[model samples]
Target chain A: MSETNPPIKIELVSDPMYLCGARELVSCIAHRIGFDDMECSKIALAVDEAMCNVIRHGYERATDKPIWVTITPLSESDESFGGIEIVIEDEAKQIEPTAIKGRELEDIRPGGLGVHIIREVMDSVVFEKRETVGMRLTMQKRADRPEEAPRISSRSSCPIPAERRVS
Target chain B: MRERPIAARAGGFPLSNDNFIDIEHPESGVCVVIPRHDVDMSRSPILRSAIKDEMGSGLSKMIVDLGDVQYMDSSGLATLVEAMRGAKNANVSLYLASMNAKVRAIFEIAKLDAFFSIVDSRDEALSA
Candidate 1:
């Protein structure tokens, strides 16, 4: 009965603080869509980095300009791969997808690390410079155990292993 | 104009070292000195105190020098955002000075370029 449902989408305005807000937003939305805790953290980190890049380089030092982030979660039937998908769009500046290179944290240079972090955390990261407007960033995450639907946090209430029976 | 060195406490780090954070309020109200590298979650606590201490002294205008910062993560950006908010609440105006393209990039990504005043040099911030 649930196989024909569409994706869930969310939109938010971009701000300097949005970097942090993006992380929180992804964590909540991903959990609501059934992603585990670790998966949610990874998505949040990726979104944070990508939005940071849009806020920085693409916008050309302008913040008043509008930057939009849209998130859509792909349902299980369509994504047998067992994960979630999110898309972020900004009408600020444009980024050259070809020019983006992920940086090694060990290398630690300044200019270009955000894109690298985004790629590192997300299963699939796609960047497209819209014809004349801004840019679109797409990210996907795959769940290892969709059935279990692992709890986001693992701190169980009762500190009882199977061996410690009530009897 | 006397220059005083203030180590970044809780609200500062990565952008300025504990030993290198400096404040120069010659004609300008306040100036913040930043270091070259290694700013992340662990060092943010230091920044808070540095800014708070400066503001406590009644300095209204500020310049944050970031000539040396090579890398800054979300934690680093958070510290700055908090400081910006703190400064505003205290009626103090803050400006970022001498940001490297990399560090400056974080500001742009965070959309902070719209909220704070930034300049090419400390002198620029001081004069403004």
Candidate 2:
């Protein structure tokens, strides 16, 4: 049902103020695409984190740089299963795809929390150097799972695998 | 200012200089800081500053009332972390209260929920 939807493109400046509008738009689209409340928030958060990174690190906080956001639907044919795909493109600084590694969540005072959230919430996250854009960060959140859905802590009562079960 | 729709829903508070945060000191030894809008990078500094002022006010406990806030990004989270550290050094306990599901999810995603004392209600926060 969602694949028939057209892609939505938003052009914004490298300013934090624009983030609110972008998040609102993304949420509206995600909702229209049948994402539940929690699913909508996770997808919106993934896009928010990406834009913040581009504005802060990619553009060095310059307010005039251009940031492009494209939202498209994911389908089983696309191997995304089912969800929303957010593509954030920046124009100022070229980023090494491999350099986008998220810092350890164990570290309290590190700069990678944004990256970590992007990774953990989204089912698939990919970064690439686009021909026209300086960098392209593509993230997809499957409608099938929310970030809080799968988190059963080590202390949970779920049956443990015998290989790693406490003896 | 621009917020507070018609009148104080429950109560009112004084806004900081930048007008980004509303600080309510309901009683002695406790301070409550509420941001009037979305807590993003641009506005986190104002909140951080307000939190700093409260830290030095000799309050024994500080509560960040998140009931009014709908969205909070990473910068906002970092501000709270820094405030937590400052509160510790200043002998003030920092508590986060009434976070909506979205804001609470942000904290959980960052794995910092356990790091902060998050309560479901302001009364719970006040009494705890």
Best-matching candidate per TM-score: 2
Q: Taking the candidates in order, what DockQ does each have?
A: 0.04, 0.41
Expressed as tens digits, the lDDT of each residue in A7-99 for candidate 1 is 445555544533555556667767665665555655676676676677667776464656666665554554463456777787866657787
Worst lDDT 10-window in candidate 2 chain A? A145-154
The CA-based lDDT of model 1 is what?
Answer: 0.61
Query: What is the per-residue lDDT of model 2 for residues A13-114, given as tens digits with 9 covering 90 to 100?
Result: 887767878987887667655576677777778888888888888888898988999988665443334667789998867877898888887888625678
| Docking class of predicted structure 1 | incorrect
Per-prediction TM-score to the true structure, in the order listed: 0.50, 0.83
Say what the RMSD of model 2 is: 10.6
Candidate 1 lDDT, tens digit per residue, B1-128?
Answer: 66554553343234424465555556655656454343443344455556667776567787667776544566576677777887778888788878766566556544456767888998887777
Off by over 4 Å in 2: A1-3, A76-81, A145-167, B1-18
The parts of candidate 1 lying over 4 Å away from their true place are: A1-13, A78-81, A148-167, B1-128
How many angstroms is residue A28 displaced in model 1 relative to the true structure, after the best TM-score fit?
0.6
Docking class of 2: acceptable
What TM-score would you give candidate 1 relative to the actual structure? 0.50
